[model samples]
Target chain A: MNIYEIEHNREIVHPNTRMADVIEADYRILPLLYRIGIELGFGEKSISEVCCESGINPNSFLLICNTYLLTDYSPSSELIGSANPSDLIKYLSSSHSYYLNECIRELEGLIDKVASDLPANQRDLITTFYKVYRKELENHFSYEEDIVFPYVRRVIEHKEENEKFTIGTFEKNHSNVDEKINDLKSIVMKYIHSTGNRFESMQLLSTLYILERDLMKHTFIEDHILIPMINLLEQSHDSQ
Target chain B: MTANNKRVLIITPSRIVAEGLITILTQAGGFTIERVISSISRENENLLHTIPADIIIADPSMFGFNILQTLKNRLSEFTTAPLVSLSTMPMSRTIAANFDEHISMFDTAPEIVKKLRNITIVDTSNSEESQDNNIGELTSREKEILVKVASGHSNKQIADQLNLSVHTVITHRKNITHKTGIKTIAGLTVYALLNNLITTPNENL
Candidate 1:
């Protein structure tokens, strides 16, 4: 797939465009997005059913559907916080952080489930590589919340003096993410067609099936969350 | 045969791909394999570090170019054994990704076998100039290294960049000069650049 290009533009894309606009622009990519939605248990079926099966909130599903019109699926909750400043900032500090933490927790577990399933011999290595992924995602998200998010809220609400430094740091973090994505791509490739079999090849394939699904969900969160947050940060800076 | 008889360790990311290659590789019977590692590990990190394989058949299509890094990290350990990554598409992205390493990429299984045959048989005794024009020309591995050297990278930088030894880089450079009769790194580099081998500064093989 052309996932490399999409991932490369991880921090790119207009901040204010509704998800609908982004998805429409990438109509060809929609089928893949739909498959991911179904894979993530957000099938074309009713949001209620998907939520029940996957245990996700319906509002979030709607939000993702709203986003998929222009973007891939949904704006990250972090983006929701950044959409407004005063109330969202304080709430983000306490509640939104918890929500995000929960998402990360589930994502990590899903990744493990997927990795444990890969065969000792297979073409791809991406089954359940949560350790490397979680470590990076955790660090990245925490940095955004503790450092960048706070700066974003402050700049949007109060025009803090030190925001440029914070924004600069957020932008620079993209390079590291690029490197991480490459690593993930490596793991994915190990799965795609890179496996060298020993004994438990079938077991590995089972693990891969699950892990691949988990990764799709995982990327949805980041692409939806980080991309919008970066845009908000940029806009917040531009306004100041 | 079985795992007990597996002598060569084939590291890849896919079981299907590994099996297909093993089936094809064994069709001729010149070499026998022992194990196939489908994961990316320190043990299978690169061709350079993995237990020496009689032949390595890689599939980097799904992984983008990380397979090339393994190859780049591998090329310097030795230059003789065959490390071939077969892709549905030829001229592997790994070649583009790990431009400084020694790994060959092919589009089809037959091409991969042809390359292995050439390596094992050493059949090019009389056709010296024919090496450059035919499939043997540039060797995906050399092309990778040449792309880097051509782009103004120092031997040390090339070594570190490709995970090859400085001695190996120098040796390759010397060999390239000798084979091409270019006489100098600058000339060799100019020749490489002119040939569209490398462009950007960080274009790793």
Candidate 2:
């Protein structure tokens, strides 16, 4: 479940309008919505309680479908455009982690159901794609919650919050990309892609195509929608 | 003490990464961790199956379970799910062991913690008595090797711990591996724990 699936299901009232898509996006409010959900965890609200607090209906299939799509990529500061680290957890969970869980449950069933649809090779390719997708998806989400967002929030809120810090002593937001993503990309090409194994060459290619599509869009949300909101939140919090 | 706090579950294979993670996770205080499983175990498995934590939080490393199946198949029966395999060791065979079972695809730790804490639902019914830390299967020599390994001592260190030559320790390592069918020191420690072979490490992990 990547961004393509969400965008692909757009049921705009008018197919003739360019604005119909983003406007019809069920995901339009996810950035802010997820931000709140993340904060709820830090403060008092359980995530599910927080998601319901905003009335987004986490159990909905469209939301579930969107959740699945958003699971394959990360929410980068560059990617999401700079949210307070505090808001990042919410932004990520609301916008990403929440969706990923939905995808995991859905994909587990889907893969099991579709196990018979493809040959061993195709199934293997699909399985491979799922593995890469889940791993990258989980890893990226963790960065925001455990590292990136927490760093931003600490920077944004500073001593305005607490001394010991609920975020504890960890801060990964200061890390450089050279330390993180590129090497990850290499592994994706290796084991997940089979490094050009004959058994999954064709099927793996298609799997990669779908993954690339979802990852790009997921990156789009994190890079575009969520990060900007964080920047805005940081500004507002600082001004207060 | 810092060594005991290496609580993260990384899944990459690079020594650069293994060294890198040792630097990072050691600073965290919640629990201690290291690669206790194998990386190939993460391939094509359920993302949940690979999680070695009470929860899971990962990234796109499993668009197709590319690393998902391997981890899941191993822990298909596990319910509390304690392995947290990261997808990027380059995630590694050593770091892979730290995870619940496979490699995580995502890049951050906050997100991982949040996800595991909130989303991953442990099926309590499926969890087993593996948590019992009272197995009594090891002999006195095996106990010595077990303690040394659990304390982060290398085989040579264990040999020194018991005043035995490294060769004797190597023999012990083989016997331990053969008797328990566990290769990594981490695995043997875990085996010791499940069978009550030794007292469990402090819950600080």
Q: Individual DockQ of the candidates?
A: 0.03, 0.01
- TM-scores, one per candidate: 0.31, 0.27
Model 2, residue B101: C-alpha shift (Å) = 53
lDDT of 2 by residue, A1-240 (tens): 110111222322221222223223544433334433423232443333433455433322123233333332222233233223433344445656544665355545544444444445434434544465466567767766666565555655553343343222322122211111222222233323233344334443344344334444444444434445445555666587
Best by lDDT: 1
Among all windows of ten consecutive residues in candidate 1 chain A, which has the lowest summed lDDT? A1-10
lDDT of 2 at A78: 35
lDDT of 1 by residue, A17-54 (tens): 44344444555334333432334333245444543455
Best by TM-score: 1
- Candidate 2 lDDT over B1-205, as tens digits, reads 4432323343432445445444444443444443322123111122433334432323223323423543443443333234454455254344344354433435565554444433344445533322322234546766767667765778677767677766556555544543453443434444454345556443211
What is the C-alpha local distance difference test score of each model? 0.45, 0.41
Model 1 chain B: ten consecutive residues of lowest lDDT? B127-136
Instruction: Provide a comma-separated list of chain B TM-scores, one per candidate.
Output: 0.43, 0.33
